[model samples]
Target: RLQRDQELTGVDVVVLDECHERHLDADTTAAFLWDVRQALRPELRLVAASATTDAEGWSRLLGGAPVVEAPGVSYPV
Candidate 1:
């Protein structure tokens, strides 16, 4: 949406799921979001949701943003 519209205006947040895979598209999206947040919208909230994402790496990428890890709970099916 950012590239197509040139800007993501009025949006509150963007949540990226399955970021632990670290695919090209995910990385690109993260980079774009980062750039947009830096240059355009400082208030835009970006959340990288994943089971195995490198919190430290992503936090650093996001200008030392805080990384909050949720407690993992599982139940057998």
Candidate 2:
């Protein structure tokens, strides 16, 4: 995001690839997610993909927001 000097507020949708990736810097990820939530205009959507509980946890974090989980061709477990 810094490449364009853009803030998350300029975004309308957030797609979290490999939602199972837990090693992403927590602060940075949280900041991005916070902005995604705050920047939305109520009708905005967030898409998280991963066959794991990580996606579900994110939904709960966003207060039961809608989540789209895509089925992976191969199981990570």
Candidate 3:
């Protein structure tokens, strides 16, 4: 967890899935992880992934990291 110090050590990447929900805990975790990436683990790969997320906003939050858009598929019910 990002709450613990040095918790992310040895981690190659951290993928926060379903970030579009935007809950309090998720927001805090994102902020802390961003801080960790900035101040401690510069090489730590961080990914905020979601199906219906605000890519631009998250990109800004993650220090202007590039937002990669993947092709989506839709099926009719």
Find the candidate with the highest TM-score and give its number.
Answer: 3
Task: Name the candidate, 1 or 3, with the larger lDDT value.
Answer: 3
Question: All predictions: root-mean-square deviation over Cα?
Answer: 1.7, 4.1, 1.6
lDDT of 2 by residue, 41-68 (tens): 4544566666665666888866797876
lDDT, candidate 2, equals 0.62
Can you give the lDDT of residue 17 in candidate 3?
A: 97
Candidates ranked by lDDT: 3, 1, 2
Using alpha carbons, what is the TM-score of model 1? 0.81
lDDT of 1 at 59: 79
The global C-alpha lDDT for each of the candidates, from Candidate 1 onward, is 0.83, 0.62, 0.85
**TM per prediction:** 0.81, 0.54, 0.84
Question: Which regions of candidate 1 are displaced past 4 Å?
Answer: 75-77
Candidate 3 Cα lDDT to native: 0.85
Clashes of each: 0, 0, 0
What RMSD value applies to candidate 3?
Answer: 1.6
How far off is residue 2 in model 2, in Å?
Answer: 5.2
* 73 Cα displacement, candidate 2 (Å): 7.1
Q: How high is the lDDT of residue 55 in model 1?
A: 86
Give the worst 10-residue stretch by lDDT in candidate 1.
1-10
